[model samples]
Target: MDEETTEEIMYMTVLGCELAKPNPLRPGVNRSPSYFETLKQCCHLPIMQKEGFYRFLQLYNDSQVVVVDPESSADSIQLTKRVMYLELFKDLQVLCTQPDNVATRELGQRVAAELDVTYGEQVGVQYRKYNKTSDKTRLRFVTEGMLLQLIGDNPTMAGYSCLVLDFYEPTSNVDRLLPLLKKAIGLRCDIQVVILSTKYFEKFALYFDVPHGLTIGGTSFPVGVQHVTKVVADYCETACHTVNQIHQNESPGDILVFLATDIHVDRVVAKLRGAIPDMETFPLYGKLSKAEKAKALRSGDKSRCVITTNFAESSITVEGIVYVVGFNSIGTFNFLDPAKEEVYLRGIKDVNAMNLIDEVGIITPAGKVAATLPIDLTWYNAFNEAIKLGCLSELIDIAALASVKNPIFLRPHKTQHAADSPHGQFTAPLSDHMTELNTLHAYLRTKRNMSTQELATWCNETFLSSEALEEALVLQEDLIEWCKARLGVSEISVLTPDDKDYDVKIRKAITKGFFLHAAIRDDSDQPDQYRTLKEGSHVWIHPNSALGGGDWEWVVYHKIEPTGFQYMDRCTVIEPMWLLENDYFYPLPLTKDYGGKFWLKPLRAIIDAIDSSVPHRIGG
Candidate 1:
């Protein structure tokens, strides 16, 4: 893989190839060796995981030196892998994020196909279960976060001579690992990194202080934007109504309806069927089967609708999309209510966090009051319970799953509950977090002997995303890996099977973590909405959440998402006195009395204490 391997072709005499009528080379024509055929065998090297495994291929660029003869040109060459997919790349490894990211895929595919000079190989893309690469592949395209794992494992990124961060976007993961990448680059000057993006970020200059940069204009056609005059209360029904109107009034072409989640996709599709029976509709997301994605991508239909999330906006391109119904009603916006939220979210300095917003204060939406935060409290309680129950690893896995937006199970359409019936086995009566734990435990046990194809089939049968399951497994593995590296645990024991108090311990953990984010079910209002303890904010559990269906009286959450309804997603049912009786949170009653209303407000002090310490993050 080193540049010194290949000797420069200084003066090569003509070496004509035998042909029927004419010799391939002229009398003075100079020719160099083609080592690409030999390079093909080493392409299968698992460069991401192993060390000192280099796949050398000088066929990428044959003519590096300024040859004396114009005829003596150097040989030229040119990739794939999903970061979580656990695939291998030959030479250069690219880390990308979007599963259906069209721009990055297009570039990778184009580069693969355009490398006419690279002997014995072409380019390919690796994401989810889709593997378009082979042993002959040189340029392997993977995701950025996955690339971080590879970097974390091998800080120097020694296997590959080059790294390309395609469609590079700013992220907390990138921010954390960029220093390691820069140090790697500095150590290995021969290692070339090409960062590609649609828009340039000047902030990147802080790490990559390059004087000249390349810019490429986008080749996409203009898309007309149409905004709604009045936002409808029922977005799905309104979206269905809009699609119907567009089909009836506007030009006849494919319509892309953007919804918040997969459930909304199914909901809108059902409404569309009733509104316009003739239209063929398909739900598009990362978790859907190939058949579904193909149906959505297929054109030539006079009129069709693909209900999807914002994934369609930049990731994949659906042909014949003449109209788009933009609706993000289910999507949550910001979560930083207190400076501590930013401190956790952005990994910001606690001192700087206070300056980012005004003085810390709680402004309740409704006059109603309660005891905890729906999401935070639940997680805290669960973590604490797990600790007491001796199931921290299991809790970490559950927490990691909850921390990500990806779903382990699919939410079937409103009319297709039968499809989602398999998830019933994993469902816990009171808490969705417990249900997720049940599912994870089952998956981990099943994964021991299951093949990828079988796993995918099992997921489909269970109304789950094999893609999401794959990502969840990655997250679970990361948590486990971090535990070993940070917490220094080789194997964490599971909760005792005979321990009856294990469940109680889990509940105690919830109360422990979320003394402040606790709440009581607002019986006067909706059962789904709750009045928070410290802040009087009336927040509803997100419909996509597993706990949403359960009517829990006292609930706790980690954070509240500031969206249409200010949803508390990761909620767990809690006992009211769990806050006051708890020693750590016992001082909450003395903090301040709000008209005799019992609630926790110890966040101001707890956050201040944590302000001096850096947040604990799973490296890589």
Candidate 2:
């Protein structure tokens, strides 16, 4: 073929080929140098040698790079390419090596000196290092607006440059800071972009779009290949079987598990630790304070396993991770459909599935075994088991839909009653003071029209602390506003706490908002005893609720419980179903007889009744 034809054929062929498949040149091998070399060679060709081709090569070289499938529709490809390119170029390098230590600190100081000379004194310099003693980390930088002031104050520093070095990737605040950095860089012509991390080359390559070079300083062998033979025997019985297979087959220091949530990481770690006591376990989640997360990343203990949520994906890099265990899940956001004038919690609707698939491999780097474990498969199996056991047809349908639509695996069955029961009852009794307090608040809101201060007085009279009442009110208002937004109600004119009936109104509001989480009073044997009803199926009122002081009531109706709380007990009242229904769970109509009076009605019927009576609007 002529050069033009060959170039055309290669370009067109690449457009259709899978970008995520095992390095093409190596075939069965996941990591092959030849594959990358071929990719670079292809990029150098006449037709392919362009800005676009350079981007493609950068992504190809970056072990953490996620290339949008060219076969994707033109619009999708364009959007994905833009986002991917922007991310790649945002940080030329991210240094993950610790900065508090002498060597790392000296490295930062040297880089800072170089930057000061290159960018001049107006540039900002910052350093972030973990303070192990205090269990905290600090970010000290020349603030953007103050950059000129610092330089003005000291004319001697006129030509000195600044460099911001973060020993670990700025995890918490930095994730929300990229846009600000973009703005700063755009506004200031003198600032330079430099990042330092142990895994900087791979991570920088994945997200960087500009001309760059990789320099490997220290020698480190890929760790723990022999440990692959000792895969945890208990396969994650979730829907995504890939995780289990990879965990079973992963070479030591080669696999990284990327979970969607910290809770999942904890659970997986616990399960794995139980199964393999000798294996070192590491968890990277937002909940861990920055110091803890940094320690987890830097410890570098051998035979170690790290389970993290998106932390290891692209923002930071850790060495020796060749295989990736991915839980294919996306975040949800509150969206308002303008045409319908309604608000709903929905999954990020237009997520690029190929990017998600690529994320797994990107974190592991090329020439590494990128194995995906099937955590979702376990969920699927559990859902199927629930269906066989006749738990709830609606739940079964929701599970089935989720299995098809989202990457989730149903948790395995715990116990017969625990699995079968929709809402688990509590065993504790409601305190006498709690009942009187609730009733008093309810009466004040309904009849007296009290203000928040008046209600606080009532709570004080009822023996609840003033501080506690204030905290409760704050949480109550937040929940009310959230509920209003969810229901798509624009106008909110509820009675103020100073009103005569404010107490009662607030109590009723709490009851209505958290109706699904109602708990039964623990009344042992005495049915007529007020607050002595059997702890049948009880959902604790959120501790932040005014009535959550342990007051229990047998509500005339109930609703589904909400999801997303971090520290909720299982078997608590069903979380308001609306939270999950709108975002995660799919509803299905079912016709089965529930044994209890409440169970007699279909789950949907009960939910509808609660929703309808709540006097709120629904969004499309």
Candidate 3:
């Protein structure tokens, strides 16, 4: 054949083969070997827990059992046992607490999803609002609260053969459950208990009388650690600058930045967006919506940056993260102290406690007032605050469903019938903050006329979580039903913002709970300054609060920010007279009792003093 004819015949024979021609190699497109991508499996050498495992194994008839792994490597040790002895122990219940020491609701779901990949239906998750476990499930992950509820319902824990506490932190729920678990062990001699932690394993082992424990070395990859020689005043700016440098000069990988607070996270995210316009930025925090959190974890075409609080250090692990910027100093915030002028800042760890109060005040039936907590004053204060905020009653009611007796009277009461206090026909008086959230939930659930998309849009606009609101409504329904069944109250009412006396009632309720958290506006030295009612230290209202720039005489705050300076969070405006009404609990400044004491002036007298101290403006 002719050459042109031959070429034409070849093209006709391979018509679609033109698409298969090797394209020119684009320059600078092939990525370098990624450090994280080239990483093999997690690099922790498995250290066997023989003594602990054998003890757990022989404890088939002994309920009080303890297994400790000082390195917090007990996760793998316990899982191996579950896999090896799946026949003997039909199901193993693992309880996990987040790094921030709160009973996390998402950890169980995350762990369960990872486990299901290998174990399929054998692994399940249990939460307050949802449960994925069934009779066929052999491995279950539950939140700290769920385990307590389980103990309340099934004291013997008849369904599970073993219980393990992972990343154990001395939270109120965990501390409360330990003694109860000991009691349960005394009643039923079948289930085994294992406590795991990196810092508290030895202490817990001593507490549980487990003399033999294992210390598995922590798993870690080859990481190059660097430290700043000099401290930077503005951490957010430094963090954003470092992230931008990495994004511009480094290969494709995600960057994780650890910040002190949600405010810092938002700030860094905003700054990074402006600097690295092509990189995707996401913020992760406890209060962020689920969709927002999911954005941080989602795989995207563009390189991503995830800025989060210290909660991400242990609770979450984002994939493809090659660079990590961490801030060492954590902000410390103190909650309401039952005693005046005293604040408990740190958890008791041997001699590491700060602002330690050896003696705590509590109201006893015999009118006695001083005692110490079994765990620590910090947990005790948390319990006290919970009781005042009506959380104890809710937990008690929820526990009652499991035939568990009320656990309120176990703690010394600071106020008479704190759990039994009736506020507006309701048995339990929720804190003003919680009350507002509940009221909003109720309004959106029943009163609002909106479709699903509209509701979601409204939630996003207000920076609220639709899922959380729905969960709150379900929880409210459950509580109301329980109140009707147990308390025998014929009338039940849901307070809303539209209520005629909602503001008055809410403020009063807040005073009753947070009387010690009262702050007075004394702008003598600064334009807007607040001081604690007891200590008289200068405090500033959080910038996000509604009363931030306002000039209110007196206000009640629910929480203090965990920063160097004391910033009042969730502030609620209250009348000065309300502080006088709660004088029985905490002594508000009284002019009659003040004998030349500067900080002990009456509320009215203090307001007058503040007014006089302010410089008079001659002209507007």
Candidate 2's C-alpha lDDT?
0.34
Across 231-315, the per-residue lDDT of candidate 3 in tens digits comes to 8989888899888888888777889999887767877887787778899998876665455577888979999889987556446
The root-mean-square deviation over C-alpha atoms between each candidate and the true structure, in angstroms, is 12.6, 20.4, 17.0
Count of clashes, each model:
42, 73, 0
Model 3 spans with C-alpha error above 4 angstroms: 1-123, 153-156, 182-189, 199-220, 231-234, 241-253, 299-303, 332-454, 478-488, 494-500, 525-528, 583-596, 599-620
Q: lDDT by residue for model 1 over 1-620, one digit each (tens)?
A: 53634312210111112111231212343322322333343233232111111111122233111001000000111122211111222344433333233334554664443332232234555643345666555455655545655676797777565564543344545565567767887777655554443323344533466443432222134567778888688887788788888888887888888877665677677777777877887788765655667778887545788898756653565766777788543563322112455555433322122222222433222101111211222343344355556877667766767755456776545425766578888876656667777887777677777987787777777876555555566556655654555444567657775788665666566556556667766545575877776556678887656677587777777577654477885677776556654443323322234676343343443333434332231111
TM-score list, all predictions: 0.62, 0.31, 0.65
Candidate achieving the largest lDDT: 1
Ranking by TM-score: 3, 1, 2
Tens digit of lDDT per residue, candidate 2, span 139-234?
A: 123322222223335432222222232313333233323334445445455443433333333443344343453332212323332233344443
The order by descending lDDT is 1, 3, 2
Residue 419 lDDT, candidate 3, scale 0-100: 21
Name the lDDT of candidate 1. Answer: 0.53
Weakest ten-residue segment in model 1 by summed lDDT: 66-75
